[model samples]
Every structure is written in structure tokens, then in C-alpha cells.
Target: MATSTASYTQNQSILDALSRCIAACEMCADACLHEENVKMMVPCIRLDRDCADICRLTAAFIARGSDHAKHVLKECIEICRKCADECGKHEHEHCQQCAAACRACVEACQQYAGQA
Candidate 1:
């Protein structure tokens, strides 16, 4: 049975991964907005937005221990991969941080996103 939000507590690994990914997305978005050539960061900006939203959704799914958690984690993995790839192309501190976070999330998802 699925757990309710009030009773939910993600396993340490899952919670840590989600938190890192969430922070990465937010940092990436803020970085893109602060780019000296903001126009050049358009793609990264869009990806950052998507990454942030998906991470949040994934976290919620895990927190509730819902059946959809695996599905959401799978999606989060794909989004993190994409975001990490994009962030790796940039030379900014935030982009670097984002890349690390995305990688961490990918590893986390692999452990928990089973049989989905």
C-alpha cells in the first residue's frame, strides 16, 4: 500500500538524491538568468525549468511512496541526464554545480527506480 504525505519519509538515498537534483535545477535556472549573455543561455534556461519541475514531482512521488514513484524517478533520470549534458557544456560555476547534482540524481534514481 502507498503511504500518505503525512506519514511519508523517503529512504535516505532517495531523499538525498532528490534534494541534490532540486538544488541543482534551481541553481541552474538562477545561473542562466545571470549569464552575461543571457540570450546564449536560452536552451539551458528552458532545460533548467523542466528539470526543476520534474525533480519536484519525483520528490513528491517518493515522499508518498506511491506506485508512480518508479515512473516519476525514471522520468527524473532522463531529465537529469539531459540537464547534466547541457550544463556540462557551460563554463559557469552554477552550471558545474548543476552537472554534479544531475549526475548524483541519476545514480540515485538507478537504485530506487526499479522495475518501471
Candidate 2:
């Protein structure tokens, strides 16, 4: 039997959030590298990359309806929160935007976890 379309459709919100978070994180990391005091943004850049990777993995797991999706989402939530915290410490527009995206992704992951 074919997999239900509902399986993929149900995760659309999280998928969208993950995509946004990935974009924001990549942009933020690149922007941070160009900052005057790049040394100060190391933590933020690291977290952004970490968060983006985890979000991508989680999105993949959820999209395939993998049994590991919930487990990966737990990690995604943690990393997203950490990334947001690090980005929140920065004053740059890209960092702020990335922080917002991380926060949104965290919320979406949590909601999906609850439903799963």
C-alpha cells in the first residue's frame, strides 16, 4: 500500500519551519563571518550551523515518518533553543532574524512532538 498523503501533509508546518530555520542559520553564519569582530560571533556561528543541521535531519525524519522522528525532534528543540539564545546575544539583523527562525522552529517541533 502507498503511504498516506496525510502523513506528509501533517508535517508541513514543521517542514516549513525547518526550511526557514535552515535559511536563516546559513545567512546568519555567513553574515557573522563578515562582522568586524568575527571572533565575538564564533559561538553564534557554531550554534547556527549546528541548529540548521539538526533541523534538516529532523525534517527528513518527520517527512519519511521514521520511527526516530520524535527522538531527533527532541534534539532539534534543544539545539534550536541554544541557537536562538546565542543569536539573541548578537545585535546584527541577521542574527536577530536567525534567532526568530530558531524560536519558531522550536515551537513547531514541540507541537509536532506533542501530536506524535
The numbered model that scores best in TM-score is 2
Model 2 spans with C-alpha error above 4 angstroms:
1-6
lDDT of 2 by residue, 6-115 (tens): 55666898899999999999999999999999999999989999998998899899888899888899999999999999999888999999999999999988888887
Model 1 residue pairs with clashes = none
lDDT of 1 by residue, 1-116 (tens): 36533233336567778788888888789878977899999988888889889988988877766888877778889999999999989999899899889888888788666523
TM-score of candidate 2 versus the correct structure, residues matched by position: 0.94
Judged by lDDT against the true structure, how good is candidate 2? 0.92
The best candidate by lDDT is 2
Report how far off residue 19 is in candidate 1 (Å): 1.1
Clash count list over all predictions: 0, 0
lDDT score at residue 104, model 1, on the 0-100 scale: 87
Question: Total backbone clashes of model 2?
Answer: 0
lDDT of each: 0.82, 0.92
In model 1, how large is the Cα lDDT of residue 57?
90
